[model samples]
Target chain A: MPKFLIWIAALAALIALPHGLSFSQQEILVFLTINVLLVASYRLLTLTGEWSLGHVVIMGVGAYSSALLTKKLGVYVPVSMLLGGVIAALIAVLLSFPLFRMKGFYFLIGSFAAGEIIRLLWKRFRDPFGGAKGIKGIDPMPDFSVGFYQFDFFEPTSYYYFAGVVVAVCLWILWRIEKSPVGLTFHAVHWQDKLAQASGVNVRAYRTLAFAIASGFAGISGALLAHYVGTINPNAFDIDLMVFVLTWAIVGGTATFYGPILGCVVLTVINEVVLRELGLEQMRPLIYGAIMILSILFLPNGLESIVQKLTKRRAAGGAPERSPAE
Target chain B: MLDLLAQTGLNAVYAASYISLVAVGLVLIFGVMGVINFAHGELFMAGAYAIVALYAGLNVPFFLAVAAGLLFVGCLGLLMEKALFRPLKDNPLGGLVASIGFLMILQALAVMGFGVRMVHIPPVTQEVIAFSEKVRLPVARLYVIIAAIVLLSALWYFLKRTKFGWALRASAQDPEAAALQGISITQTARIAMFIGAGLAGIAGALTAPLVSVNPHMGHSVIVTAFIVIIVGGVGSLEGAIVASVAYALVHTFVTTFWDGVLADIVGLSLMLLVLIVKPTGLFGSADRA
Candidate 1:
């Protein structure tokens, strides 16, 4: 099958997905859709050779910003969500000044400290942030109808469809950005900043750009989550969620764009569907931990490496294979 | 106001003691192995739970339980070295991920074995030392402070005077050079892991009666430790200790005057400031990070 046909088929499957699932699963699907965007955005940041522990908190910045906009300022829900992304991007630009000074482990810890400060701010200020309990009863996406279908917002399927379209478009933009010259600069920056700089690449500017754009998408994802979940809290964007994102990126392998998405989807299925159905709620973390360790130990290159290997083997007997841009 | 300040100062000292213990261990592990043990906090929790099992559940003597906590958690560190860190030695990122996995496993084990509820251990002593009418220090807090000083001083002596200590420091400073000098990297790694994990364990064991013990308790512990280590400068033991004291004083005073959340913000902001101004930390050199 050609690439376009494969994409169309995947889109059709995604469109048809929630209809076959139970109500709770439909809700999970909506979340999964949002997380795909979240992880994909995180990949963009990693493209510039930096892993931010603050990414989830930046997502929270979006959720909190959008939630506050809608709840306090009475802005339109959709407009607030977009503004939320913009605000998150703005915050990333500001944070980049202090954060981009450090590299490697220092950057990791620096980002984490930056994120904690934000979360602590949320907990300290109850006036607008609603204190530790966070903003509750966030406005949902207003119900609307297209010619062929109605979106009730109350129904998970409807929310899934709404979120799915937004995520698909966001993913497309992210894909385009990754394939552009800027993306190549990001890769160059990742591999060797000095070389990229010598070759006339503005390393810092590209790093900041990737950070801002990734943060923007993450914010949008957070906004989608806030509306669907009907609430937002400091705890919601805590380090645990960050760890999950990190796990997704690592387990799926960050070598390719689809890697983290594949990891997120697969892990979500196992965690939500398999573990939940097995009634092993208590043991979920235990099993997940084991899986993480096993994968790192045995499949250090990630699940994507396996996929890459299989694809390479298949393509070996065919025409010469082109290396992935990644 | 003076009395309150004094009391808060005493509290800060107590806080600094445990924080430094944890931070030092973390720094030690990172220095030698070149991987941050995300599970360090969980190791502390394990130490607390060891007390819960031995002292609270089985009626062991408090001091003996504390000792057992140290040894048991130290052995757990050896297990980590043999199983996780040693195998993934070449891959620091992999080691980090593995430590995270170990952290989750330890937390889950705690939840399963002891339930998610907080466990309370009986106080070994109810005595409070009164500096003044309002300025008082609990005897238990003094125990932590004393242990921190004695252990740190002894560690200093060992590092300066002992061959193994020299070996450990040598490996931490430059692993290949240390190995070329006939020091076994594996042995030094084991020693560092043992001491590092032991320090955190002992901190948890000493403070078990003072703080609420639970599976998720490690979360905040880890956060505070991270802030301390970052502010102290990564891979610098002296820096970790000094930063822990500085952070504790600032945090304790902030929490006293303002609130707990603000204290956390202040601590984190202090770290960010250090990163921005001196990315190597207050006492750190540029090469370590």
Candidate 2:
């Protein structure tokens, strides 16, 4: 019952959170929400024990697909977003054919090479991709009314609420997937591929499944950003951003589901609010790099490990009286 | 048309020289240490910046600046090994992530120190070796080519002929057995990191006058090096050289006839093909990586 109340309270806080922020902070909140999904999806891929440098490009695939589908084919904004995710998943599946042939460091390099080729293709083909400038004037989600609230697409607060709900649903689905047997198979493949294969688990298929699903969610995040920003270029999803995502995952520690999310939120707050206020924006990358290294060296288990330790201590101390009787 | 082909060939040779230099260093580091040094391209950039500061800013002689660049970047490598790689020796991925952090630090420092614009160094020389009206190679490019040949030959002789070379090779092949045989992993690692980083630094310094010198210039160089090392086979110095030459030929011709983007596309696609056909690379055995 207490856990249920905590969930309700958390939901209430999320719903009320954006109202207190300034205009730019609300905007940052919306991006932070989308990035939460991006990093979470990235964690799903990492569960299979292969870290890819191409994930942001896969996200770009989603953004591009969503943008093009709405502009050229006249698809509805919401529908195009779903299609964007589906296309990104399909592309991941296709890439897996060549990419899955290698493992470890080779996989990392191959994926990077594959992503660069995709980006270059977008650069070379100006017809639909808009060359280097990328697709602009992207269609925004049409404003609509719900019974309790009106969603004005122009307002960051409204967009935040809408994206928040969408992201919550996506996170629920990801959580459920992680808890399922499929997720267990992903763990198995990661830890002991040979053993998993020997147990008739088809390791390659699970790896492909994880990659596809992760790309699908990443695509959705990209679509959300595309509709909100109304513009994107190949540079928007370059290696610099990819490194940021990688750092989030690493610094957050990928052992638990919420680690990367925590890493993303904390880093975003540090990057956006704290740094911006202090007027150290130019030193953001340098400071960020230092943070990444320090975290890796000192907190190898991530911020969640601290959370875990605290929770364990609370459980031990608080439950000591009833433990023997129980 | 024949003259154009010859000119393209010369360009390919120059490209091959610098690229092989970078790729070989990458290979050497990967071989000796079981970690991929993602900061390698940044190390190359540091070398170029050394020349930028010393040769261009302080008016040092070009050759003296090149030597300084090599030694300085080599020292940077040693710092990485001691500070980052050594502690995370057991976890290759952690080492890689740390190197990436190092890469960002280097890039940020470059940006802060030099600002974002491309830095122009006065050309080392105005002379060009003319084979024909269309076929010519600049003196600066000649210096890079000569340096690559001499340094690589020296590296080859050192690796094949010296006691330290055997120790490095043995450790690369089997760290556990090498340790059992009384080889100092730390010492070998230090040597490998220094030479590997120095090689990349020298390549960057030599080619600084010929190419655009910017903080982010390392990106394309690293990409080219990755393609070459993968095509040649990871951990194989000989394979890196062979693959570099082949890649440069194909890329140079494609850029000459078509466009630079297409040339990149081709180079990447060729790497993918090699990866698909032979993941161990053309010359590498399956056990190394």
Return the interface RMSD of the candidates, in order shown, one decimal each. Answer: 2.0, 4.8
Docking class of 1: medium
Cα lDDT listed for each candidate = 0.91, 0.91
Candidate 2 chain B superposition, TM-score? 0.99
- Least well predicted 10-residue stretch by lDDT in candidate 1 chain B: B280-289
Candidate 2 Cα outliers beyond 4 Å, as residue runs: A316-326
TM-score per candidate, chains pooled: 0.97, 0.96
- Evaluated at residue B228, the lDDT of candidate 2 is 93
The root-mean-square deviation over C-alpha atoms between each candidate and the true structure, in angstroms, is 1.9, 3.6
For each prediction in turn, the share of the native Cα contacts (below 8 Å between chains A and B) that it retains comes to 0.75, 0.50
DockQ of each: 0.68, 0.47
User: Per-residue lDDT tens digits of candidate 1, residues A1-326?
Assistant: 69899989988998888888988898889899999999999999998878889999999999999999999899999999999999999999999999999888889989999998898789888989998899999999999999899889999999888898899899999999988998888888988789999998899999999999999999999999999999899999999999999999989988888999999999999989999999999999999999999988898888887988898787766433223222
- Scored by TM-score, the top model is 1
Give the DockQ-based CAPRI class for model 2.
acceptable
